[model samples]
Target: MIAAVRPQADPPPEATRAPEAVLPQDVHATEAVRATEAAHAPGAAPATARRRPMVAHDLDGLPVPRAAYPLTRLPRNEPHASLDGARIVVSGGRGMGDLAAFPILYDIAARLGGAVGASLPAVDAGWAPVTRQVGISGKYVSPDIYLAIGISGTPQHLAGIDPHTRIVAINNDEQANIFNVAEAGVVAEWQVLLPALLNALDHPGDA
Candidate 1:
């Protein structure tokens, strides 16, 4: 039987950096540098017929695959805002209730110096733009902090979030899957909590 396993966090950025052009201890590392030099070298023979070394079915009977980048894109009345490299992402879901919740979400994001994201349902319900959708079919996000409001963590949604990102879930449902993966979670209604949060954000320390 197949078992579910949560993804582990990636190593530190410095540790994940590409290896040096030539590592003294690694003889194979020098090949990349040598090949680069050979590419620009004068009168160097081109490797036109070369293919990857692997064990596979007969190439003679297989069809070649083709791919292409889109040349044209659908235009929109309002320009789409990208969520790439956002430091903080305040995402909402269908559980956020009516359309009024979105303005509050946007306000919160602005106050936090972050971007807004949404689940598929919210996008389809016309509460949020498709550009703001986060999921397997949507844009992948690797933010420092992801604050999920009224979002039930679905595999489709979670797939878009990086393992390194810190998740903070705010949901009324006690059994929400979001809490399973969240670093921290709050069980409360966003309507009640968001207003209070906004008040706190507006006034730092007044009783």
Candidate 2:
């Protein structure tokens, strides 16, 4: 639904200033006053006329077109660098069920200082909101830690997450595809695992 933007050509430079006219003492003083008035004219100063507003180009009593300053920001080197704190991402797969448990996922994400995301199937099934979907067709997420629960790792789903990110998966099936990409795995159901996770977080060092 977006329209293509046409590239714009750079504007031409301003015409050079004419050499100052030499005149008698009184005439020279009057000319100086006129120059000051011209410099303080309304509008932006030209590149050459740092302290003065640029005079319009006059060709045979006719004025040429005027131009505005191109105040644009150039591309920076660290484009992907994050100015904010570290991010943690929690993504749910098909095992998350009808998304009736989304609140629990949101709560977990809040606890872990992260955002919530969902797999393609969960998004398609209307379990998770479209904004939270992760995959080629969804938004790409590059969080510091990626925790995937009840998910089967699909290439499409993995495309949304960074390859170098730390991944943790939770699923009952030990042979699930998600385990392949997970740095850590726990063979457990989310319904039970979530409570255990909450308890462990609440009571740290009390294993």
Candidate 3:
């Protein structure tokens, strides 16, 4: 007996249409997509980065640099003549911080009729003015007597003093480094020594 024939059917045309290509997933969401699309759309060019211009501000209402007055160069001048007859050079150092000590030195210098000098530290610390500084970076002084009060005799301070001048250092400590360079070392407090010196000066015949 012959088998019954089965009917053949064609695939639906819509199904045959290449399965609609899967569109790329918008990973970022709508706003980002819109921004990206706006940035890279046809006929859209990348923006040029802009540089900000520098703004000038006047300094505390001061005039501008170009408008400021030009400084004039003054003629070089020499210092006044040193006193040749100056008998003594009374010098002080940083150790003399006690404000009370100043008057003693001042009085001693006045009595001896000598100029007052200062070490570099004293000047730098504002204890003494720069004008009175006697050191490597200050005035070089040569006098008959160099009385150093509490000075430790740093090389810089010694640089300004004359080598031939008789150096007298007064300090409370006997082992002070100043004693090494002093011709006469007095191991007594300057506060005590100064008054004693003043009294001796005032009284002529005293042992």
Candidate 4:
């Protein structure tokens, strides 16, 4: 036998439904919201009470204040030697030997109108000031011409040197790492080379 189908009735409308009973917690929460709204309403008193101005009391037996002292400005020291924007940089390393080599390096730098820089060991040995040191731990430089004197060309030292600069390495050891990166190299001792270079600079035709 075939069964007859019956349609389900639709749910009641929200407007016609009875309102839900408010719980004790919900009643308390509604009262709190109303209280907050009333407290912040226009012409309502401030939530926080006004405080009285505080009076500072001096301690008995305190010492009298001292007179104002005048301060003198400190005299400026010699200007710091910077290599940031130099046209050329003549840098020396430990291979140049002792503090004596620095003056020669400085002279060369001066003649070339360049700045003087130093490697870690030269600075540590007191041959050059800390301000002149160049490496990862020191100043980074990018000059038109970078004249590296007796520098072994460690990765750390090379890190401070710009790759675009024309590197001229002067070292007695032909196999020195500096030669690998140098655009031009001179395999000779600084003692012999420096004097010759200075003399050449003094007399260009003789050079």
User: In model 4, which residue pairs have backbone atoms overlapping below 3 Å?
Assistant: none
Worst 10 residues of 3 by lDDT: 26-35
Q: Can you give the TM-score per candidate against the true fold?
A: 0.61, 0.56, 0.56, 0.60
- Candidate 4 C-alpha lDDT tens digits along 128-190: 888888877888888887788889877677767766666667677755666555554555566
Q: What is the lDDT of candidate 4?
A: 0.57
Per-residue C-alpha lDDT of model 1 across residues 43-118, encoded as one tens digit per residue: 3333232221222222122221122212132223343335898888989998998566787776667777788899
TM-score computed on alpha carbons, candidate 4: 0.60
**Candidate 2: deviation at residue 176, Å?**
1.0
- Using alpha carbons, what is the TM-score of model 2? 0.56
Q: Name the candidate, 2 or 4, with the larger TM-score value.
A: 4
- Candidate 3 residue pairs in clash (backbone atoms < 3 Å): none
Cα error of candidate 1 at position 119, Å:
0.3
Q: Which has the higher lDDT value, candidate number 1 or candidate number 2?
A: 1
lDDT of 1: 0.58
Backbone clashes for every candidate come to 0, 0, 0, 0
lDDT preference between candidates 3 and 4, better one? 4
Shift in Å, residue 192, candidate 3: 1.0
What does the lDDT come to for candidate 2?
0.52
